[model samples]
Target: MTATMRAVVLREPGPVENLTIEELPVPEPPPGWVRIKVRAFGLNRSELHTRLGLAEGVTFPRVPGIECVGTVDADPSGELVPGQQVAAILGGMGRTFDGGYAEYTVVPRTQIIPFRSDLPWEVLGAVPETLQTAYGSLTVGLDLRAGQSLLIRGGTSALGVVTAVLAKQMGATVLATTRREDRTAALAEIGVDHPIVDTGTVAEQVRRIVPEGVDAALELVGTPTLPDTLAATRVHGTVCFAGMLSNQWIVRDFYPIGYIPTGVRLTGYSGTSGNLPPEVLQDYLDKLADGRIEVPAPTVYALDDIRRAHADMESDQVIGKIVILPISGQR
Candidate 1:
């Protein structure tokens, strides 16, 4: 009898009902590919877009996940030992092929980032993609430096909070936004110096706090608020467009000469796992182990509860990243 693993298969994009958990044969890794015994995975908006059919170039009957944390089960190349902790992310995961929403997943060796972590799998699961995007946004997109003033739009989102934590660590005074005033406390816990309740006039509200505007702004709210985000930055300041929580990325009309503020630069970040250095990941893991830093607390779900998980994610009430534990009772 062939070994089988439980996986979530989405036959077609439509609603949350399309995600179904089923038993499937464990996949084998060819030469150049590695098989991972998935411990846990993070739910991302990228997967949600794929589920809604808003994403491009995705095929049906896919295991939709962009990132997973696991131990190496097989590496035909013999470079990775069995049970070595690793994370697989991006590089056309879930979209181009079967991804991490399973007990086992196979990916090209290039997609894997190896690290040693005694942290709980649930915690580790949330780190890969979230850290990759946040760290890359700070370093590559914004070149954020110590003692700068930074603002994070959509501050309650998973990426927002992670960026806030990282910005504070970099010695930047952080201002972040939450849609609800009650969530301000959550932002504060993550070291947000100012938590503005976004009522669509974030630029006005931000000026009231910083006067000359922030030294840098991280735009995660999508194009609807991109203009206001630009207005909230100081002269020569940068805004890195990273997330599309509003699902409105396009501006419809292109008039950047008139639209962008004078001396304010706008860049975007959409990097893969390889963009994040391995030592950076290991250092963050070590900090988590030593309690020097923290990742946002995640809402964890078992693979069996994928439907509810997607429902929760779509509802947008959760404040942090959502994670899936493929093996029940793992953490």
Candidate 2:
């Protein structure tokens, strides 16, 4: 490999034009870190927010990718070896540190998980962020159980879709909301049962589906949909706030006594808890490898075409996960 590698760097927080490809010295692994030749990276909404100067404390001229799937080039800690495939999820990646929007990246060994060789590189990139977030939120935080019901707002998003799939796998009936009619059909193909169009009557529709209201609701659409989610959830049910795609308004009209009487639980989820505890992530990966669970990779882009990928992600045109291939290989 060359001593220098090409990387897409955001020279300053502006538009996609600010992102440029440049040659930089390849990074070496630190004590507990491994150097990776990145095969693919996954795009998240946080990247766009950081690029547009919306995310605070993000420095300029930074690489902005949250998740990556790559082969280890050097493992100084010996916990991983060269040529082994692995996946990485964002903790401080693309936020407080340099990220995976490059041909190579160095990640701490503790943040890396072994990738299943049976899955494609693009699929591997799609897994770390979305699956870990979904799994951790549903099972660990919300304490979701079998025979329960869940309502997921923004069902077509990468994390939302993964949450829906995992809910089904855990034997929970899932009701999801999508603004686009075309996406509803695709969501159903991935195990979502009730796909509601994001109309003003979303709560009513959810009520019709589960008359007692849903046992839980995953709030990905943020404030605009929070009211509907709150209205649709059953007494004593949990509402997991996983994403903030819509508005960030906090509900003020409702009295605390209302929820107290109803016994509803409101909570937030962040996947920064160290990649789903290894063992659970391994079990999920095993299921993915054996076809017991389907983790979809909806779009793939070459590393050079990263600007277009980010644009598509910001526009919400892509369905599941948008993958950036560092090596010009097919999915």
By TM-score, the best candidate is 1
Clashes of each: 0, 1
- lDDT score at residue 301, model 1, on the 0-100 scale: 91
Q: Local error of candidate 2 at 297, Å? A: 3.5
Residue 292 lDDT, candidate 2, scale 0-100: 88
What is the C-alpha lDDT profile of model 1 across 1-331, one tens digit per residue? 2499899999999899999999999998988999999999999999999999999999888999999999999999999999999999999899999999999999999999999988889999989999999999999999999999999999998999889988989999999998898999988887899999999869988889889999899999899999999999989999999999987888877798899999999999999988978999999889878988875679999889999999898888799899999998888
- Colliding residue pairs in candidate 1: none
lDDT of 2 at 99: 84
Give lDDT: candidate 2, residue 49: 81
Ten-residue region with minimum lDDT total, candidate 2:
254-263
Task: Quote the positional error of residue 41 for candidate 1 in Å.
Answer: 0.3
User: In lDDT terms, how accurate is model 2?
Assistant: 0.82
Model 1 residue 117 distance off true place after TM-score fit, in angstroms: 1.1
Candidate 2 C-alpha lDDT tens digits along 156-223? 99989889989998999999888998788888888888888987548788888899789999988877
